[model samples]
Target: MSTTYKVPIGPVHVGLKEPVTAWLELDGERIVGARVRPGAIHRGIEFMARERNPIQVIYLSERICGICSFSHVLCFIRAIEDLAGMTVPVRGQYIRTLVLELERVHSHLLWAGVACYTIGFDSAFHLGMQLRERVMDILELLTGNRVNYGVATFGGVRWDVTPELAKAMREMIRYYRREFTPFRDIVMDDPIAHARMRGVGVLTGEEAVRYSATGPTARASGLRIDLRKSSPYEAYGDIPVEPIVPQDHFGAARGDVLDRFAVRVMEVYQSLDVLEKVLDGLPEGPYAAEANLNKVLASLKKAEGTGWGIIEAPRGDDTHVVHLKGGDENVYWWKVRAPTYANAVSWPLMFRGNELADAPLIINSIDPCISCMERMMVTDGRGDPRVVTRAELLERCRRKTFDMMGRRA
Candidate 1:
């Protein structure tokens, strides 16, 4: 006698603006099987960069996603800079590190809010968002814009954080102590939160290692590979690093939602620690090598060769590859492999055999960036799931408008 029946979860709700679906076989509300329906939004962000010119492409990179905008630019710029055989100034590197860490704080807080919402803790969601707003404010003050801050440019930064902003980082850290510590205690130490999470969705250390997971996911599962330490891009190598590990960094890494959550919480603190060190020895130099637009354009001279650059983006490792061609409009091929590529692979393993109730918890635990994930469509029958996207709908509207025209050329 068998009592397992299929119960579908997601195309996640408003709690997470990302679209995702999980098919779980349930035995009276207990999950017996699971499958992650991810291809819903693979908008082809990966291959799109190849079509645009390098200088003209920074803006397109910015549109990759609002939350991880700077990191996207950082990755692409690092790749292009490597191709040009150029190195940014030491001060510029420090500035880039600070920007990256600030973005990390911003992103972690945003994830905290979304996680809270997924778990139905609305108050915590609002609190996390409010604190997250502080980091966003800092970004705007330094970058001259909110969201897609175009602060990173090849060979260096587009803008500098003045003395005023440097001071603000210290005070803001103090304010965040009040906001994050309490929230951290509740999410990390509270029994209720633990009951909801804890061993509910356990990804063993071996599984995490075998899957090649990175960032907090791997860290949570006890995989110790933060690219900052291993690869040491930018100036992370210059500053000392303390792993935001569980069980005090020496214990066996826990591959669970709580462990993943705790690693991220502690990582925010470590980011601040790194930034303070970078600032203490912040260098001084011109951001980009060229002094004027003509010089900058001339610097992009197409060379016949191939190269690659890899950066530790906020979500994880993001790589960019370039193959120079003699006359291929600036360069030959620019390829980027964002962290999501590896992160998504772990979803199936994470969700499988987990209870249907823990779908959201596990999905967000990998922290799949849907905007980064791209296209979203409901692939199941009887759902009448309006599988229309803004592009398709707009194209249809444009087609109708052209057909309605009384005169045509």
Candidate 2:
């Protein structure tokens, strides 16, 4: 007779960066079923967006997730621009594309680092993070911020990449091109990485479609549905955009953890190439269209309309829907659907039939962002501490950091 038990990891786990609870039902060593709960960090961003004016909402949207911040604002701004029937300057379009690609490089690098760490490869994890800093430095140069780059504005970008900055970006890409080969070799040649990743957390193409998985997760499962190519927003239409499904890189897509990692790594190269092309042919025009917010708001008030916008964020397609109120500066309705929401559906499928020991790597493979998918968490006072004072919270944070550092040491 087989024995069954349940294993609960997180609400706070060393493996996860955000708040997520995973309950796994195990039969011996294998997981028979799993449930993932998200949303302890929900701040009602959509509701908050409805309260702010269009201009203010740009900043509000940017706060959706620190990593996907620019994508959020871009989707929101594009929705507003579409509602108002405004055109973005050509150079503005190019710059927007450039910033987004740079963001992709950084995001992918960050995920790669996390994946490495999850697999217990500290060297690759550190190397991935170190290489990622160059991308962050460029982001800082362009937007004056390392995270939450507030560059995309309504109908255009706030800052232009000057000739010198463009040159610097080119050099950065060149450096990445030189360094990526060794990184790829390290991940691909490692027998342990293959043993751990291949055939693990396999999601078939049919299953991926059923769950509506997106980004590298869906691409790994042989879905060729990148919004950049399918929808063609911003400069995607002007430049040829190719979706890197797993089969394109590997002979056949296994739709496993290894395939997901391969797709993201290949995408970093593709984004670097796209950046070069966008910069080389960057059109000459103003960074932002000349228009006063008051005039734009008046027009929107007189002729209110609903608009929907979608952009291929690093993780996947991020979408926004907005309805402008007649004779008001604020929107009547605002909706945001992030990639994590779509990808969340596949978690249970990935965890089923896998070992409990593989939980963290399987979870990391999807790159779950619980913060983006807001829900509710209830804690009963019957057996729990009611209030967590600031001192406790601070001490807990410090202890976690110290533990992590100790492990590193």
In order, the Cα lDDT scores of the candidates are 0.73, 0.86
RMSD of each: 8.4, 10.5
Q: Give the TM-scores of the predictions, in the order they appear.
A: 0.86, 0.90
lDDT of 2 at 274: 92
Task: State residue 136's C-alpha deviation in candidate 1, in Å.
Answer: 0.7
Best by TM-score: 2
Worst 10 residues of 2 by lDDT: 376-385
Each prediction's total of clashing residue pairs, residues at least 3 apart in sequence or on different chains, is 10, 0
Per-residue lDDT for 209-293 in model 1, tens only? 7887777777787766777888787888888565566767537666778787888888888877776787778877675555464
Model 2, span 127-225: residue lDDT tens: 999999999999999999999888987778888899989999999999999998798789878999889899999999999999899988999999898
Pairs of residues at least 3 apart in sequence or in different chains that clash in candidate 2: none
For model 1, give the 10-residue run with minimal summed lDDT.
400-409
